[model samples]
Target: MAKIVIREELKPKRVIALMSGTSCDSIDAGLCDVFPDLSCKLISGINYEYPEHIKSKIFQIFSGDATIKDICQINFAIGQCFSDACKVLISEFGKPDFISSHGQTIYHYPFDERIDNISLKSTLQIGESAVIAENTGCDVISNFREADIAAGGQGAPLVCFADEKWFHNKNIAIQNIGGMSNVTVVSDSCETFGFDTGPGNVLIDYCMQKFFNKPYDRDGKIGFSGKICDSFLDCLMQDEYYYKNPPKTTGREYFTKQYIENALKFAPQNPEDIIATLTALTAKTIASAYERFVYPNVGINEVVVGGGGAYNPFLMKLLRTYIPKHIELKKHEDYGISSNFKEVMAFAVLGYCTYYNIPNNLPSCTGAKHRVVLGKITKHV
Candidate 1:
């Protein structure tokens, strides 16, 4: 490789990041002022739900039934949503220096696939950068995962790049229980490693949508009303993904709607029990991950959780029960960041890193061959 030097005289700037995680529930925008010291102040955050029609189309495509034409259309369709979000966020919080769009992850296939002659691994997160750049009238950064995957990595659980910055001194575990749960163990020495722990809100939300006809378990009320089925919990515990080593990632592909349906059948046909069991499973899997990978090696003393699960009290209660007594559990907000907006904020930081030619993808966490600058930048001409 040829030598290339990045000028180190860049100034701190305001960045607006837009994200739609595996949940496919909504697009969230966060305006962040990122400083040289790696500190970020969230100027503002706004949430926008996808129109039911667009959401249905996206989900249908996710199910693998959509044609290539559908993928092409939704790629820009989602970008329009992101562009609109950026326009609104700029209006409310003033225009940022740049827009960092994490876009919508339609599919994340992390495993190795061998084709005709060679082995390949890829991950896709789509939101057309040109659309964002044109609509928002600013530079845009998107597709942050492809570089890591190109270097033979899982291309996921990428937030540790920002998590280690947040807890540089403490032996902390930052867990984001979004559609899928992922854990990042950041040590006092700045050694950070992470992986997908397993299913997070995805399963529980399925239970709620199926049984209660609600989008999610409000404060995990349904779970609180029911008792956990030990048998079902044990059955879930035996799943191979939990035992698989780190440097791994999973998505809706494995834990599909059918998986949830099958799990409910294994239980005693009570909606509450099913949800409670799913909640317990999420907590236990996280605790198991800590016990197996993090605790023995890093001696982590704190578990700071974020994502939608942070708002579910019963799920938090289950987490408290399953995690060790020596480790204190707290929400990301307890540390001065809003739980709902942290991911988008992290992307802002990642975008900042990319613009400055700084390496943002942590090899220790993503299992990449080496650290690399992430994100593809689209400059407005």
Candidate 2:
């Protein structure tokens, strides 16, 4: 261990942010120049595929088939994967001031489930920061969720902080459709807030792999070919998660393989229809969330779609169909943001705040009692 000095002067810092969303698709690494004012510009990025063996173990954990030893070993394994991803960027862009790693979330239990009379609300993101630091030779800031949860927050939808920084004063909703969809409502009238809107590509991706033997619904072609089963969509919309109030969040923990299989019992005979209905469920839940939580509170002038879903024409079409026609629908690219690497860039900003000792979590969005700086710093020796 070494004494890590925090830069005292406010200036631009080049940071590389690494993350692998619940999709478990790839490790997304982005190089960004975070300015003193909190604005960040993406310099470069890469989607590094996980080694087949490592990826299988991750999926095993998701399926609840992995043991404690597997989880323990995979932490460093994934850290090495992250460090390798950073090396790719570092080789081309050079070493950044530091690296920001979101790691991979193995389990996120945000509920206040009481056990032995003690409320348990916790999250685990596993790429060991020390491993990342040692491998990259750069100070690393990781585990961005723990502090927020400790502060009585759900420990998610952290992008809202960056959304507020970038889209404030404008009545807009930044809807990110990733493994799971979430939205941040930035308005001229009220404090910025956001919540998980429901399934994004999670169910659809699962069904694609299970039935079609594909990784995902690329460009949503399969989804486009099928008709949405309204009856099934109705059933999915009834989920309690959809009805829950804001400052809420969810992930693979709730939408597990068992949950999907159970829902499939009521699904249409046609697998494509099942995919279509799941896709529609995503669009409908997002629109429903807006209708229930957002529209009544603040007027939105635009809705910006980002993440992997932005590339899915079918999902985007459904979103456009369900969202109000009057409100403009745009992608992150339209605003000069990289749709694939937006979250990567976001973590860069979060890490910048951490390095500067600035509070990064949006209490209004995450339901923390107050503002607290997120992330733990691991200094490179």
Candidate 3:
């Protein structure tokens, strides 16, 4: 690979952050100009959809039966996709200082499971950073959750560190509804923490693919068309994870096709009802998280929403209905950030922190033993 060198400057150089969440939908990437003051500018961003066959392979692994050979190979394939995303961004925005990738989260364990009398806790984020480094010829930082998990955390809600920077000097909840929903509560002191609230767009998108042969319920229209089945909604809400305390994380392993299959036994027969109920579940659980964990302590003034859920008019409407009127709810766009790009942008900042040896993981949010710099760097040379 021919490398293009960026001249070092006093200001933090531009960086490219690439991400593919558990949703397995598309690669979201951003070009950000990070500053020493900790503020950042999103110069540009793009969403690269995976080819049908590649997406099929992703779902294949999500089924949990893929052999090690499949995982080993697909990891590289996904890396190439990530690299391609960076290439596109570079072609448009020029070479960045480095690259940060929140690779595909194949699995994220919420709690320790015992085996051989030892608590086994782990998480996997494929798409090798070495591949990104080699392909982009820039330093690549990735595998952000491993260190936190090793330190006895749920290995999640890492964005809390960046959320602090995003809304400094405010008592706010930055709720991102990606494959899963998580809330980062930042106090006026700039002290920040968060955890997985509950399911987000992942469940709704899975239902869309399963029932309507669509990637997602565009604008949550299918969900809007159906009535929320109260009984079924209650049953779905019964999941203990929703009620669990903070420092928790989950993935498709806990809420996926098999999950829906089990729920179908008691769910209303109408697919749209099931979809609507799931949407309500997301809205309700997110609000419940804030009401239970956030509002009591900080009395939040704003709930800035981001990610795919922000685009779902019905999901936003349901969230609005559930949230208290005392707090203002706004989309990321209102703050001049693209809903889909915030997480990717955040990772770019994380990568910058890691490079400077700054501690990036927030112990309060991830339950880590202490603050530590997150992500491993792979050098191109």
Candidate number of the best lDDT: 2
By summed lDDT, the worst window of 10 consecutive residues in model 3 runs over 1-10
Steric overlap count per candidate? 0, 0, 0
CA RMSD per model (angstroms): 1.3, 2.7, 4.3
TM-score of each prediction: 0.97, 0.97, 0.95
Residue-wise lDDT of candidate 2 within 133-187, one digit each (tens)? 9998999999999999998899998999999999877999999999999999999
Residue 233, candidate 2: C-alpha displacement in angstroms:
0.9
Q: What residue pairs clash in candidate 2, if any at all?
A: none
Cα lDDT for residue 279, candidate 3: 94
| Alpha-carbon lDDT of model 2 | 0.94
Error of 2 at 39 (Å): 0.8
Name the runs in model 1 displaced over 4 angstroms. 1-4
Q: Give the candidates in order of TM-score, highest first.
A: 2, 1, 3
Candidate 1, residues 7-67: lDDT per residue as tens digits?
A: 6876888999999988887899998999886778998888888889998898897777899
lDDT score for residue 358 of model 2: 83
Question: Between the candidate structures 1 and 2, which one is better when assessed by lDDT?
Answer: 2
